[model samples]
Target chain A: MTWDWAISVLGILAGLCTTGSFVPQVVKAWRDGETRAISTRMYVIISVAFVSWLGYGLVIRSWPIVIFNVLNLGLSGVILFLKLRSAPPRRKEA
Target chain B: MTWDWAISVLGILAGLCTTGSFVPQVVKAWRDGETRAISTRMYVIISVAFVSWLGYGLVIRSWPIVIFNVLNLGLSGVILFLKLRSAPPRRKEA
Candidate 1:
């Protein structure tokens, strides 16, 4: 296979894997009903970053980049929303 | 700014954030001495994926992609190594 074709295939796989990385966190948050461990600041920064990535993909017409970022943005948004809705992890009274 | 420059800037930010997403898990594993919650299969898959991504970046001559994937590869490798070396989470006897 030509080098470009090979790397393109790998790039697609990488995109899928990278996006898939978030699946576990989403599943855990949904099943456990807790997102207290995830930092709000991190989520906020990531969401903004994903949006920018999406914009970058749109500008470049890169479907892989666009699709992955779209999914990531949604995943992070859900986690952030859940974090906000869920109460903080229970603390023991001194 | 030209679209290329704008998107490039955004892409850099996205790469950083995407790579940064794994930091929390790495920190937790190191601090708490627990990686039982993470699936070995998942880490294996991600490490391979990161390697492929790095290769893809090299082929494409994308510095942002290369740097991000290299860092991610290292981080995931560390977590995987620690997971294997550390004892598994203790189970309560029934």
Candidate 2:
């Protein structure tokens, strides 16, 4: 196999591992209502970050980056929404 | 500007944004003792996820991927340790 092919395979494998990691968090949240454990700002910021990466990937047409970011974009967005929905709205303070 | 250069710039910007996103979580955890909210499994799993990406990036020799993963690896490690340190240990279930 060519070097580029090997690298692509590695990227895909890495992407799968990282992507899979979020599944447990999602599951934990669903099963235990663990969304409270996550910070709303974290999820929101991460969603934006992944969206930027998704845009970059689309522009460069790198499937590895594109695929992972696309998947995570949806996942992070849902997580963010869930966090916001479940958490008490921040109180307005002087 | 050349297409490749533009893509690289985009990738870097995306990387920075994604990398920056975690700062809030770390700060939140430190300031609010918010580690109670985070699932230990999430950080542990995500750390492994990024380590895999780091390996892939190193193999592929992609500087953008490598740089982001490296920065994130240290950050994630610190966060994971903090989560473990601050949170109460899981009980021995019958």
Candidate 3:
């Protein structure tokens, strides 16, 4: 395969890894009903970043970029929303 | 600007956010000295993914991809290492 095609494929595969990394975080937090351990600020920043990715994907007309960011936006957005909705984690005993 | 250039810039911007997202996670986890709250499996997977990204970047000759994944690898790698080194979180009371 040509270099461009090869890298594109590799990029997609790498993106898939980064993209899917959030799955367990969301699934476990949602299932456990406690997301206070997660950092709201981090996720908020990430969500905005995903939006940026979305814009880039649209500009490039790249389906993988578009779809990846969309899913990430949803996953991170939900986590942020949950964090906002939930009470903070309690302090551990001294 | 042409579509390719525009998207490249946008992608760089987006990639920055995603790339940096691990910063806070790493810092907080390290400072707090408690990564049990963070999923070890998620990070192990992500670290492996970052390697894939590194391979992809190397193949593509893209500095952005290479640098991004390198930093990500270090960040995630540290978190994983810490998580492995630390004990699990204590059980919460009913």
Best candidate according to lDDT: 3
lDDT of 1 by residue, A12-67 (tens): 89878867766776676777776544556556777887898898889889888888
By TM-score, the better pick of 1 and 3 is 3
Task: Write one digit per residue (lDDT tens) for candidate 2, span A1-94.
Answer: 8988887777777777767767766766766665654767777778877888888888877887898898988877767766776787789998
Q: Write the per-residue lDDT of candidate 3 for residues B1-94, one digit (tens) a residue.
A: 7767877778888889877887887777778876544666678778878999899878767899899889989988987887788865679999
Model 2 residue B84 CA deviation (Å) reads: 1.2
Model 3: lDDT of residue A83: 74
Assess the local accuracy of residue B22 in candidate 3 as a C-alpha lDDT between 0 and 100. Answer: 75
Tell me the deviation in Å of residue B56 in model 3: 1.1
Q: Which has the better DockQ: candidate 1, or candidate 3? A: 3
Quick one: RMSD of model 2? 2.4
lDDT, residue A8, candidate 1: 79
CAPRI grade, predicted model 2 = medium
lDDT of 1 by residue, B1-94 (tens): 7867876777888878767867776776777776544545556777888988998988889888789989989988977887787745679999
DockQ, ranked from best to worst: 2, 3, 1
Each prediction's DockQ?
0.44, 0.60, 0.52
- Give the Å shift of residue B67 in candidate 2: 2.2
- Clashing residue pairs in all predictions, respectively, total 0, 1, 0
